[model samples]
Target: MTTHLSVRAPDRDVLSDPGYQAYLVLRVVFSVAPVVFGLDKFTGLLADWPSYLAPWINDLVPGTAQQAMYAVGVVEIVAGIVVAVAPRFGGLLVAAWLAGIIVNLLTIPDFYDVALRDAGLLAGAVALSRLAVRYRSVQRERGSVA
Candidate 1:
């Protein structure tokens, strides 16, 4: 029986090494920042995160705005972990999440600027995702874990 090696014969992947470094930086920031913010959600040490929720949303929620934010925090924590585990797709998830936040802020009064800022972050997240795909592809070609 011929035991064929099914794995792709991989060599070193040096394409866009510098660019991959940028991807790594973005991955770390996006991954760790959410965990930090999610933890802060429980303590409310950074800011009154729930207060930022639109008044209408606060009313729509079953519980206090704080409780809604706790849920948001949980989602953020999971998203952050996802980014750490799978940045290629996770960055896109974060970007989508930011787009939703931006939309929410746009619905609220006097938060257009914050929404725009988040839009910028969303762009960064997109770039990170694209770059990460290339980086991950390289890692796979190299037959190594990043």
Candidate 2:
């Protein structure tokens, strides 16, 4: 009597996978963009950051519009760092931040265009979060995650 043994093929490299490649691109972009924008809030090279704040939001906060923007800059910087370290949660954080920005923009006159743009960004953040979930699962199976 002869016995045959079956051998399983090794899994494909995740780096070569297209979905993983997309996730990497999104991860890098999401991680860097917010940090850059957040820093710019202090420099004002991009735009007048204070001008973007809605009057209602400014009133609700305990400071002037510019002061509020300073706080916003801090939050954005932290969010960006979080994305670099843990994208699964960072993406949701960015999405929530964008949602707040959208609502604020909608309340301001002549800022509807900005609100629409933020909505698109919000969608991208959500996508990143979903992709991170899949990536985390793969990492867990590989014993790379604790």
Candidate 3:
């Protein structure tokens, strides 16, 4: 007697999968939003970016708050690029960055509502990280011969 083992094809289309779709949406949003916001830091078209900096944090860093914002803009641009190229790590990077922002906002009495919004963003970042982990493993498995 011979026994047959069945294996599913590795080339299955994942675009239709709900999880993959969610992952793609999140990846794109995370990739774009940060870069746009980062650019705005220099242009100040959105808001006075430096004014959002907590005084304590400003004192801790050298130079003025605006200078710090310039540095932040660079970091944000880099982070967005990372998310675009390698979301598996980028998601965590964004989450960590958001955590810092949350702490900074909490220090400012007038920005609690903004902090709350950032907290929501932090959660989304965390979710993206988790989803990235799942999809990354799936991709690796799909690339390998079964």
Candidate 4:
């Protein structure tokens, strides 16, 4: 009797295949989520995180909570654009920004859920970065780095 064994290889061939789709999905999701939330920061269409923390933000940030909100909006919007247009650096930037948010959330007890979500999003961004790095490396080896 002959038995056939199939091995899922992480070699260049497998990495070159549709496996990179995972990266694209993560990239798009991370990119879009920031854009959406960032827009809400400006438009107040979504739940206003600031209002919830208004009582404390003034005491914490020294009369700069509103400015901080706007700044966050700008950062998130820019990060979103970067992630959507420039995949290479965007993933890393988004991951870093999300890490900052996670830190801030850790300091706030009421916004734990938002912080957790941010963490999950940050993980996705990291996954995208890893995938992007792997794909780029594979492409460079093949002289087709995109």
The 10-residue segment with the lowest total lDDT in model 1: 7-16
Error of 1 at 53 (Å): 0.3
Instruction: Report the C-alpha lDDT of model 3 over 1-146, residue by residue, as the tens digit.
Output: 99965555435576578888888888999999999999988999999999899999999999999999999999999999998888878989999999999999999988999999998988888888889888877867776311
The local lDDT score (0 to 100) that residue 70 gets in candidate 4 is 74
Worst 10 residues of 2 by lDDT: 4-13
Against the true structure, candidate 3 reaches a TM-score of: 0.87
Which residue segments of model 4 deviate by more than 4 Å? 1-18, 52-64, 138-146
lDDT tens digits by residue: candidate 2, 2-60: 99654433246977778878888888988999999999888899999989999988889
Put down candidate 1 lDDT per residue, 12-102, tens digits, no spaces. Answer: 3463467876887899999998889888889999988976798877888799989998998998899899999998888999999998888
Models 1 onward score TM values of 0.86, 0.87, 0.87, 0.72
Q: Which ten residues in a row have the lowest lDDT in candidate 4?
A: 5-14
- lDDT tens digits by residue: candidate 4, 1-146: 99965433345664567857687677788789888888777777787657544344458675566666776788888998998776778998999998887777777767789889889888888888778877777656655534
lDDT of 4 at 132: 81
Residue 84 lDDT, candidate 1, scale 0-100: 93
The C-alpha lDDT values of all candidates are: 0.84, 0.87, 0.87, 0.75
- Which pairs of residues clash in candidate 3, taking residues 3 or more apart in a chain or in different chains? none
Candidate 2: where are CA atoms >4 Å away?
A: 1-12, 143-146
lDDT of 2 at 63: 74
State in Å the error of residue 14, model 4: 8.0
Model 1 segments more than 4 A misplaced: 1-16
lDDT for model 4, please: 0.75
